[model samples]
Target: MLKKNNSTPLYNQLVDVLIEHIKTNLDIDEKMLSEREICLKYDVSRTTVRAALNELEEMGYIFKRHGKGTFVSGLWKEMQNLSEAYSFTEQMKQLGKIPHSQVLSLEYIVANQDLAKNVGIQEGEHVYKMKRLRSADGMPMMYETTFIPAYLFPDLTISKLESMPLYELYPQVYNQDIKYADEEFYASVLQAKESEELGLPAGSACLRIRRTTYSQENKIIEYTLSVARGDQFVYKIRHSKK
Candidate 1:
């Protein structure tokens, strides 16, 4: 039941109600009530129901299929704040998800002009390239490619990354620490190869993030490009009034 007198808008109230219903009563992939049914039950207009549904979809609470109804999403869906510098594994662990990674490729290569510029390294320098598919609770989440100067991490190997988070190995194995990182984000449609890696359809919306990480001395440590599923991840930012 909706209270008309409450300060919250009707659509927002409905969104809250639906989220509660999904959390308590629905299972993953379970179809939710239709727009018409929701309207009749809540005594709201079609516009209001649509607004609520749209918000829910954006928040990863539900997903709609063509010619089909909306259904509950999996519990592994995660939200990330743009201001935080946590690694993917750390973030997932914070959200109570079991994080895992599959190392697709790992090899040493000479940095090209573009790669060197992004990583603050000289061109023709040797860099270790590592590609991985990250997952949470056995579900593919993001595909990432990371480049690290080989000189800084002489002993890094594919086996080490497959066993633990890369960040955790930094200080313990390499005697280097990541102090902070600069990230650039952009919207992209997944390519056929990327879609196959993520288990998503080609042309699915995704967030492409490029990150340059530095050590306490401001020396460039790593450069990484990652493609995250748009339907499963949300980036949040918080601003404070001065």
Candidate 2:
């Protein structure tokens, strides 16, 4: 129920209520209450309900399907804050969603001069190149390729990589403490292969995330390129006053 005499507009109040419900009770693709249902349940007019729903849609909290109804969007389904370094597996766990990664391939390759310099390694140094598809709650969200300096993880194996997120093994298994990470993201379209792996149509808009992980001594640990479906991800960057 809404406070009819409150200073805030009825529709605005309704929007806030629905946002709370979305965060606590809704899942991606779950159907939302119809305008009629909302009007009756919240004791608001149809106009007010409509306005609240519209606001939710505009904020990327919900999406509508013609001939059906509005549903929770993937935007609120999985969120990643770029303000801090992140681990996909740990983040999903924090959100109470199961996280999984499928390793598509792994191979040893000699690094080119540019690649070596970028990762703080010697030219022609061998590296482990890996491709993986990552998901949350069984929904494909990102397809990524990672490069790790072979010299750093000499005992690295495909089986070990499949067992857990690469970041988790840094300190526990490899005795390498993470110093920090640098990340950059940009808008792009999914390529054919990437689209297929991520379960999206070719040419679908995507956000490309490039990250480089560093060890305690500032040595590059790994470099990764991740492609996240634009529809399924909301990237946030926080700013602070200096």
Candidate 3:
């Protein structure tokens, strides 16, 4: 029941009530009560209900589809800080979610001119290209494609990639130290194949990230492109007074 005369706005109160219900009563992808149902049950107007639902969507608590109703977005949204570097597995573990990666494909290829430039490798150099789908709690989170100079890591294999974070393996197996990395992020829509891999609808909004990693000697060790679900990730930046 909502207190119409309370200090809180009706729509805000409704948002809180709905969030509670979602946290305790709903499962991932479970359809929420219809707008009409919510209106009647809460004795609120349709306008009020829409306002609440809109806020929920923006906050990543739920998502809506055309011709269908709102549904619970099972996983809690992950917050990423642009200043830190952490593996997906490590970040998810900190959030109490089990993380896993499925190796989709691995192949040896010669770097083209564009690839060589991005990776700071000579043209025609051998590289190992690996594609992986990373997930948390059985929900697909990111589709990643990584390229590494094969000569630098001769024993690197798909099996090793599946079992552990590549950052960890670099030090242990190749005796390489990760000195730093550069990343760029782009707002984009998922393509047909990308959506299929992530189990998301075509044209879904996503974050396209390109990363270049360097070893202690400043040699480019890896270049990766990843598409992360926009709804499930939010990047936070902190500013300091200079």
Candidate 2 local lDDT, 1-242, one digit each (tens): 68899999999999899999988898989999988998889887899898988898767789888889989996743333442438888777767889899998999999999889768899999998989898999999898899999988997888999776788788889988999989899999989988888888999999999999999988999999899989977767644343
Q: Give the TM-score (vs. native) of candidate 1.
A: 0.65
| Tens digits of per-residue lDDT for model 3, 1-242 | 99999999999999999999998999989999999899999999999999999998876689888889889985454423342645778778867999889999999999999999888889999899999899999999999999999878997778888667888989988888999988899899999999999999999999999999999999999999999999987776545343
Candidate lDDT scores, in order, read 0.87, 0.86, 0.88
Which regions in candidate 1 have their CA more than 4 angstroms from the true location?
1-85
lDDT of 1 by residue, 61-178 (tens): 8888878988888632443344264589888887789999999999999999998887778999989999999999999999999999888889778888776688978877888888
Task: Please give the RMSD to the true structure for each candidate, in Å.
Answer: 13.9, 13.4, 15.5
The best candidate by lDDT is: 3
What C-alpha root-mean-square deviation, in Å, does candidate 2 show against the real structure? 13.4
The estimated TM-scores of all candidates read: 0.65, 0.65, 0.65
lDDT for model 2: 0.86
Return the candidate ranking by lDDT, descending: 3, 1, 2
Runs in model 3 deviating more than 4 A are 1-83
